[model samples]
Target: MNWYVVYTKPKWEKKVAEKLSEIGIVCYCPLITQIKQWSDRKKKVEVPLFNSYVFVQLSETDRNLVFQVAGVIRYLFWLGKAAIVRNEEIITIKKCLSDKSVSDISIVSYKKGDKIKLESGIFSSQNAVIQEVTNTHYILVLESLGCILKMKYKKDV
Candidate 1:
């Protein structure tokens, strides 16, 4: 079976993936661990790499089965066709996310107005645009949400 992309409710990728798996559907929900800091303490948490999206391997006949799962909204479509993700692409994503060198890969030089995929921290994997830079931090604008964030730069990233 080929892989197809599924859109899910907000913050439901993991739950949808688990439910699909329980019913014998093979699903992939890539997750990344990042540190979340609060006023009192800090902790590392696992979050979905692609928010609100999951990958499932199934044939056309199984589409309805997937739709039956809670939190699964619909298949991602392009030009009225369900989007098919190539196996190699999935493998590459898995490799990039699972590698021990992920931290090294996260470090990047960004410029003003450049769109960046947040690699770690509480906003891990969120897309934002650089608005300003300082010697010690970056000012990012979350364009979609109309919010601004200041992130401190760390050597290890």
Candidate 2:
């Protein structure tokens, strides 16, 4: 069996892997614990190493089995063929699972109109207004409160 990268629905990597496993497709979804601060309390949550994607350990030769797993949009391939991930990256991700201090907090780029929700901190539940997009953070204005705050997000978050 070989590991093939699968592109799944947004926020569905973990679920997809679980479903695939139940149907006899082995998967490896590396995860790390992230501390999220929401107003009064801070809680640690497990998150995937890569968002919207995960690796499945299956036989690429078995095309029928590959296509049967639910939530699996497609396998990532190189030059029209399935591309397997190197063993080292998997090892690195496994190692990161134990690192409590490690986190992904970089903000993604924003367009003229994009929907976003605060992932953490004081404005955790408040939706942000995209005022300006920057390389490091998004300049968001809370229209109702008339306060502008910059939320930092990681590229991997």
Candidate 3:
């Protein structure tokens, strides 16, 4: 069987994975733990590493089984064919996420005026421009929206 990617509804990655697994379909929905702080409390939560996406291992004969699962939008396609992910790539992601030290490593290289898409957090998938870079954060200017946001570099993008 080959691994194929499926897109899920918003916040449905975990649910879809669970449902698929219950039906005997092998599915993987990678998650990351993050500490969230509020005015009076802090808590750790697990969030999907890739928003709205899940991986499934199956053959072409079983492809319809995945589509039958609720919340699964569709399979990701490349050049009109389903995209295949190598087992090694999935293993690497699992290993990296398992290592706490490497979890927060951000390796993006951005310069002023470069356009980028936010890959995580509340403003995820929003487009912005790099206004400035400091020692620990990026100053982003959302020109069309007339807003400026400060964010730390993250590897998710």
For candidate 3, write residues 7-126 as lDDT tens digits: 999999999999999999998998887788999999988888888899999998889898788999999997799989999999998898888677563334688999999888888888
- Once superposed on the true structure, which residue ranges of model 1 sit more than 4 Å away at CA? 104-157
Taking all chains together, each candidate's TM-score versus the true structure is: 0.67, 0.57, 0.67
Global CA lDDT computed for model 3: 0.88
TM-score of 2: 0.57
How large is the C-alpha RMSD of every model relative to the true structure?
10.8, 9.0, 9.6
Q: Residues 12-125, candidate 2, lDDT per residue (tens digit)?
A: 888887887888877787766679899999999877767777887766577457567667788787779877877777777677665667656332447745767877788888
Better of 1 and 2 by lDDT: 1
Report clash pairs, candidate 2: 105-153, 105-154, 106-153, 106-154, 107-153
lDDT for each residue of candidate 1 in 19-113, tens digit (9 for 90 to 100): 99999999999988889899999998888888789999998887889978989898999679999999999999899987896673232467898
Candidate 3 residue pairs in clash (backbone atoms < 3 Å): none
Candidate-wise lDDT, in order: 0.88, 0.74, 0.88
